[model samples]
Target chain A: MDYGWLMFCILLASWLGVELIAKIPSQLHTPLMSGTNAISGITLIGALVALAHTHEPLTEFLGYLGVFFSIINVFGGYWVTDRMLKMFNNKNNRK
Target chain B: MNTDIFYVISSILLIHGIKLLGKTATARKGNFISAFGMALAVAATLWQHPPQNILLTLTVALTGAYIGLLMAIKVQMTAMPEMVALFNGFGGMASVAVAIIEGIKLNYIPAIYYDTLIYFSLFTICLTLVVGGITFSGSLVAYGKLSRKLPTSSINFRGQEWVDVILFVLLLLSAYMWIFTHSVWSFYMLIALSFVGGCVFVLHIGGGDMPVIISLLNSLSGVAACAAGLILFNKVLIVAGCLVGTSGLILTLIMCKAMNRPVKKVLLGGFASISKNKQKSTRGTYKPISTEDAYYILEAAQTVAIVPGYGLAVAQAQHAVKDLAQKLTDNGADVFYAIHPVAGRMPGHMNILLAEADVDYDQMTELEPSNARFGNTDVAIVVGANDVVNPAAVENPDSPLYGMPILEVFNAKTVFVLKRGQGTGFSGLENELFFKDNVRMIYGDAKATLTQLSAEFKE
Candidate 1:
């Protein structure tokens, strides 16, 4: 894996993230924050790989914790974001 | 077939999802899209590289899912800020665990596999651990403040800036030592000190600055994930983490701009002295108004604006507030909610609470429009809001909150401030709006007070 290529991906993604998120209405900022927070749990991939193909007790335990916590973040963050967005959406429909 | 294609698909979904998340009509769908993207990323990883201790991974994953679902379903709306902070903390700890495990494998795994790993992987390892450590600890402290387990004020002392600088320098030294010498002991120090650094970092900022800290820590967690992605050589983590990192950073900047504060000032400049020394900057008399009398005044008003603050959320009065707003609308008052960008404990918290209470989304307004309409408004009902409606933000330059935008509630023909006591707001600064001739104080729990006002209208 070339360091330069990894840097390239990161830079491009960052620019796109900013462009995508710009001009959001203030009412949706909380949902936006929680949504992006859920996306941060993409680290679950790293955690999954770390846990896989391993049998060493101590390292395995560490990876196990990683898997547990990232899953919680991924699931919890998305569910919370969904609930909030639902509140906003429901209110719009009634009007 | 290159399995990396899964990562590519996941990244595309995330980018598209975030774009839709920004708009009003498509936010829910966007959230679903991103969640699906996350599921794909997780499935691809598990299918491609299966965990050897299958039972252990499955057990851990199931428990996490149950707890996550429970938390989402069970949390009260008032506690949403704390819930978000807790989730951020957990996300950060997950990153830390991932980085630590990677470091452990790098240290003990066979030298042949390590040979293929670049030396820079060590740097990313340290980066992930340190940033994740800071995010985890800082977010926990934030959660404590939001939950009222810790004092919401800045715990500042003399020369707080010097302490921060010295502690930061120590963290840098430990990271540099760990990277250069590849010593596990230095690695431990880096991890330990960053956690300490995190606590010290958040403790000196006032609670009013939470919107800034939460967004900033949110950004830090993303950067941590990016570093972890580098360690695992996972493109999905890199793209997703980098996207969250940058977007969170942008949100942080927006929150700071709304408060009219520089990022460096909120991050490092101690706020205790600023808030402490500026107490009692202005003084004026206030009038108390009974809800019974207020109902009469409201019956004749043609236009009204409701400015909600953190106190409204604390009292869980959104439902009662909605009732009152509906009653006012029945009386021919054109009522709308004025939302300050930095309101409640987090961004858009009041709006969520109001929406939860069934308030029409169309009736809510943002700062600039609300401010502009206050002059034409017949009545401005401030529900347990003080600092946000404070004229001190505009007129009293000596006040600590000077130069920050406010609801300009005083611009209305008649103003009513519902307060619990005569003391200044949580920021501990005097509110000029309370002293205005047009303003009257209604003292009680905001929910009870609003309920009474609505009952008065019901008659």
Candidate 2:
């Protein structure tokens, strides 16, 4: 079983899934994006797997780079998303 | 077994995070849950092969973390959509870079299957690169325009449509060469052509269509990511990218529907010119009112509902509005703010600006909830809002905003409109609400007029 073939299947499936979700109306987009961001969090798994496979110097270097950037994207994306939501909280409790 | 457990837990967290995003109340928690999941996934992956060279990895991680922190702390809420576009663009760019690097690395490889993969990768790479590059540069321009760092007016040159067509043809030709000849130089040329095409497309669009444009760019970014995901053989990337791409396209279509415009018409340009011509033809049909007369009516109204728009945003008059509301409240008149869903420059624009001025959130009601209350109100004070309150939406079938729900402020006992002049809104459509017998226009800067009205209320 070729991992490359498996990868292609996954890509096609994902693309189809995304297209299906995209067909939803405009009003649903913000919520959908919020949902998808969480889905993208799964990329961390790939980063980890990529890191684990490489004891070699170049693979290790790329793996580390992937690890570092993935962390920022994951954590930072979530943090900012949280703050943006707070803006809509409507907590009129301001004295 | 341990890795399997981590995967299960991470996947659950991701699902939970998405659930949280469903309601406005739980959106923050949803984001945190997802973030935590991502962090867990990263940790589990890294721990599986703990960087043998730990120092370099740690340094790189810390530096990236610091810059991200700075952006989070400093970037304004109004700029959120632009930032989202920027990040999506970066993701797309990253995918293109990865595909390019992979192609170069395998340039000398011996596998026929790898050659096919290279061809597919190159095609996706160019598609994503062109789209992503345009989205990136175009979004930056949008940010600048929204922030007032760049002019918001449409930058139309003579025969611009012809130029755009030529560029599109060139881009298509270059894409063909890259696909068939496998020429790297053609790929670079395609990149340049796409970037220029993006700039021209965005420049032709007016401020009114920004939300639609942002959503479109978002879709492009998603497609780019999916393409990149293919090159990397990553299931998560493929799934996530496709979701984003498809969602974006759907959103763009919805936005087009909302504006009563076709997606093809929007993409082809010249909307601003048509709108401008419409405005010119409709000018001078109604008599304009003075500030003093407008203030007299405002002074006497028993209940007033204030509707703010992009004009109020331009004047930064939220504080003045808050002051006016307080004065109205003190004068024994009931006052509330009517906020349209897509008002101001972005979603929740009026609410955010009003919040900055310390306006109580409870006093602000969304369009649907507030529209019902407007008819009973004695006066509707329209501050810089145009199309959202336009009577044309309710009455005219040929009107640009026909069939779309509006604030129905025209039904109030008296309608007091404060505007800079008789200038049209971002949509470039004439607001028939301005010409209504019950409506009176107060011409001046919204900030100045509101301040005067506040003073009169105090007196």
RMSD of each: 1.8, 4.9
TM-score of 1: 0.97
Model 1 chain A is weakest, by summed lDDT over 10 consecutive residues, at: A51-60
Instruction: Report the number of the highest-DockQ candidate.
Output: 1
lDDT of 2 by residue, B1-459 (tens): 354466447545654665556555676677678667656656675666466557876786687567556665676654555555454444444444444444444433544445665667566666656765676567557666676677776777779878988998999899888777666678678777877877788777777666667677767665665555565555445555565566567666666765556777666553566664643233335556666666677677788898987777778788999999998788788899987755665544576677657677678877677888887988888888887787777787766567767789988998888888777777678788777778777778889988988877655
Chain A TM value for model 2: 0.60
Predicted structure with the largest TM-score when compared to the true one:
1
> Lowest lDDT 10-mer window, candidate 1 chain B?
B109-118
lDDT of 2 by residue, A75-95 (tens): 555656665556555452233
Cα lDDT for residue A12, candidate 1: 97
| C-alpha lDDT (0 to 100) for residue B56 of candidate 2 | 74
Interface RMSD of 1: 0.9
Per-residue alpha-carbon lDDT of candidate 1 for residues B44-102, written as tens digits (9 for 90 to 100): 88889988878878999999989998999999988988888888888888889888887
